[model samples]
Target chain A: MAVYTHLGAEDLASLIATYDVGELVSAKGIAEGVSNSNWLIETTGADGAGARFILTMYERRIELDDLPFFLGLLDHLSAHGAPVPRTIHCRDGDAYQLIDGKAVALIEFLPGVSVDQPTPAQARAVGAALAEMHRAAHDFPMERANTLDIGESLRVLQHCGGNALATVDPALPEMIDHAARLSAAWPQGLPQAVCHTDLFPDNVLMRGSSVTGMIDFYFACTDAMAYDIAVTHAAWSFDKSGGRFDRAIGRALLAGYESVRPLDPVERQSLPVLAQGACLRFVASRAEDWLETPVDALVTRKDPMDYVRRLHFYAEAGDNPFHPAAD
Target chain B: MAVYTHLGAEDLASLIATYDVGELVSAKGIAEGVSNSNWLIETTGADGAGARFILTMYERRIELDDLPFFLGLLDHLSAHGAPVPRTIHCRDGDAYQLIDGKAVALIEFLPGVSVDQPTPAQARAVGAALAEMHRAAHDFPMERANTLDIGESLRVLQHCGGNALATVDPALPEMIDHAARLSAAWPQGLPQAVCHTDLFPDNVLMRGSSVTGMIDFYFACTDAMAYDIAVTHAAWSFDKSGGRFDRAIGRALLAGYESVRPLDPVERQSLPVLAQGACLRFVASRAEDWLETPVDALVTRKDPMDYVRRLHFYAEAGDNPFHPAAD
Candidate 1:
């Protein structure tokens, strides 16, 4: 949720020197990334004008061995000319450098802001961006399993215990029941592609409804392409608490995704269940974090009930939420 | 310490239009500032090239009424050709616009890094910059008393109680004793200037060894200029934990300030007491925060012992620390 590593100017200067980027001018810690430290690095370019970059230090919830896959995906996506920032390799041609036993990488800075209350057009653009990324990542050389899958969600919920979940939110215990139902009804073997499983609005960069970049590829993995759409829809269609559903934005997202690669009938059919599954993913994770904190701690932990609301919305709305409304 | 406010792109774009600086290009939440939300804002210039600015949303630990003094000091010091950034006036000629009950201001982004590990030359530059600010702020219209002075420190310590302090560290109550002594012998009315009382290394931005910006004037007030130097010394001259003191940095910093505005005899003699007072200020604040947290909580609060160590160092070294060391 915040930058865990405290990098100094001297440290940053030495790190930037390895990238063939000119002298380091400044590095500001960006208040972003869930389990990593990110800096908006500025350096003198070959033309003496300052160049901007994002230097990410993998701090937590990341394996050092998985660096090649994450960095390689960005490389593959960028090489395919998707709107993804390429991972800048060091002079030694390495994707990342191991500093103090943690892996860090330099990424090209793309211009744009991440819209929280995205317009319908912006939603469509993000949908298109995801579809394009799916196409670009179709032939990526490396592979990693989606570790936080249906089984894992159930395991986490069980680990949290029903009483603990109830303590956090009265409705949270029912998420376990929903997870079981989702597990039984989960779709099997549709179309597969590399999925940006966490394509919330924050992971997207936009300028005037155009997506300049799709970032934070740490959670990316080989998964059902339709599941990615469901995840993005579940993410962008609702308010943070999942109390309000924007059907227009939801339709725009699906239309934008379909605009690039038209969804198969099978993919469309699996969406309702996939969306429910997506909701449960957040439910399990947020519940674990919520239950870990004391009952009265002032620490601002995310409410798992947010996802519980989304799960119920999906259950009640079914396929009707995806239909486009007359503007 | 972190961005507490979540400003959406729409919120930022509308905010930027008020400043008349440029069209919003991008805004990143900078992981800086102790109790305010800061965004590293980028906007397109009239020349069509992009420019950078820091947009701050005053969240907590700041009074809305005191904004004029804070922003006005920047405008005053900037006009006086000090290396401080000027506040960008709104189209309506306001220094800061009230947004949803919180005051927001745009400031010219200065180029430099907030060095955690500062060089001797860098320390010297920061000292010179402080002296320049003191001279420039000699006739500023607004005046705010040093609220977080020795008196406040003692008050906060008394509020925290001896048991709470002892629980944090065995020697924390010793800080109370030292603080009392400093309060009893505290110098009265020698010299007055608008002092940046919290001139830590992070507050002073640097390019190589040169100081480009002296920022984060939230704690600026009319206080002893010598006390400002002592605050900067207690801040910049020691490691974060205050376990180790750098003699070269201390000597260089004092010499640099003396170069700009030569220290009076009384001021020079009072450095040790002022430095100890500075450490106690930090100790009081950190102790309060530390005592408020649960003993087993994983929250990474700053240790008050860090400043406690510095307080002890000042007590032992006396005036010896400020004198130039033999090469």
Candidate 2:
């Protein structure tokens, strides 16, 4: 949402020299990635002006140990020909290094605009891309378990329950409690795969109707394949306010995903509960964020109510997992 | 310093069509200007990828009337062969238009890095650019009086006088009072010209030893040409923490200005007072900004004490205006 750290030209130039990249011409702190400081850097090589690349300095929210997993996953996906950014290694072959006491890396800049209110075709493209990414990352050696599983969701819910939220609208806690209960009883034994846990519309880049790149792999982890599909459905099927679910977008998305890799009967049957769980996870995290984030900090705190409405939508779908959208 | 607005692709693409710029490929909100929302837009022309341009949406701080003068001054200087960006007019010949209730315009994106801790050569380049801008803007039809004059400084002082700032240090008021007195006694009627009042290092871009462009003309106004030089000197000479003023940088800047248009005898003699006035202006504005800006707003409110230190430096110079530095 904002560039938390300011990098001077001299400091940036010296840092860029650690890579085999060309002479640094300029770097502009672009407002894209929220958890890290992202600068769009331009350099000049023997051929004159070179291509642009993103120089990212991982911020506080990202753990240092988890970086290798994310970077390796990007490399693995890229090597397998998925439309994902390849992390550019340093002169010493390390993909990232500490600069000014923060883990920093340069990645090949993906050229495309992100569609927020995506069209059906764009949603379909994103669905296919997500499937491609999941397929490509299947054999990625470095594995990290999902951090925001039901366990973490329950933890956050308890944390939120202690706060003043428990006082205002008692039904809020009741709803989250009911969703957690449903998630606890839900079917889990689906094909396990590496999934982009945070596949929001803003994270997917598109050029016209084609998906050019998928970014922000910090949240990537090994999770249930159906759960990943459910998350993607939650992201793509909702409006900006995150209230009304668009069936056309959900239909196109599911069709596109199935076009690449067909879902098993058990996975398909778990869609409604999986979607509810996904929505519940977001609601819990966002509620925590809304309560915890410092008002002075320069980050946009997403409304927890968006996911609340999503949970309501999924609850209405009941046991008819595929329902009006995916069917 | 931060991008306040987020525009979707569809809205931006429609906006791009109003101009002759090619198909919009992407628009990244580059964190540069604090007063306005700026996006670095890339497009693809008939011959493949086109050049990058800056799209600015004037925010609350900038006055509506002053835009024409600022835009026209850029046009004037650009036409006079100065290395400044020309305001790109719309298809209907309007330089700007209201979009989503905000005044928006496109300008050619200037390529270069901004040097905060400037070397002597970079100081010279910035000084030369400032002089060239003043010379080029002399005949510009639009005229904007200096907003932060001695009177304005007095006004801000009185305003700050009302706040709890007066209770912190009694000496605070005295220092500002003395600086205001010095400013009040500044020489009058000394070669009035269109001056880039806020010609800080951040406003001037450089590549190697050469200045690629001068930008952010929202503060440009007709004032004592020597006053502008004084402002530029304050920018080029100071360190980041704003304690020590570099003599070498000041010498190079003055020399560079003289190469373009030599300062008159009166202008040369009036340096110390004008420098004090410039310092006072920043002190007053920064004081107001510090007191007024909400802690939540994504703006870097510069410490007023920095200019307070500069005021002390100028006060020590007394009548020996060209002591150790400008001479």
Query: How good is the docking of model 2, by CAPRI class?
Result: medium
Highest DockQ model number: 1
Q: Give the lDDT of residue B178 in candidate 2.
A: 70
Candidate 2 lDDT over A97-173, as tens digits, reads 99778999999888788887888898888878888988998899888988888777877787777444554344467
Error of 1 at A298 (Å): 4.8
Docking class of 1: medium
Q: What does candidate 2's lDDT look like per residue over B1-327, in tens digits?
A: 677788888888888889887788878898888789899888885367576889999988789888888888888999998899999988899889998889999998887888767888887877788788888888888788888887788778777884445653445577556756776687888998898888887788788889888989888888999999988887678786569978888888888888898887888888888888888888778777777777766567787788878878877866453543435
> Model 1, stretches more than 4 Å misplaced?
A296-298, A323-327, B296-298, B324-327
Q: Could you tell me which residue pairs clash in candidate 1?
A: A1-A34, B1-B33, B1-B34
Error of 1 at B117 (Å): 3.0
lDDT of each: 0.88, 0.82
Q: What lDDT tens digits, residue by residue, belong to model 1 across residues A99-198? A: 8888899999998999989889999999999999999999997889999989789989988989988888787888878788899999998999999999
DockQ, per model, reads: 0.65, 0.62
- Where model 2 places Cα greater than 4 Å from the true spot, the runs are A166-170, A294-300, A319-327, B167-170, B293-300, B319-327
TM-score of each: 0.96, 0.95
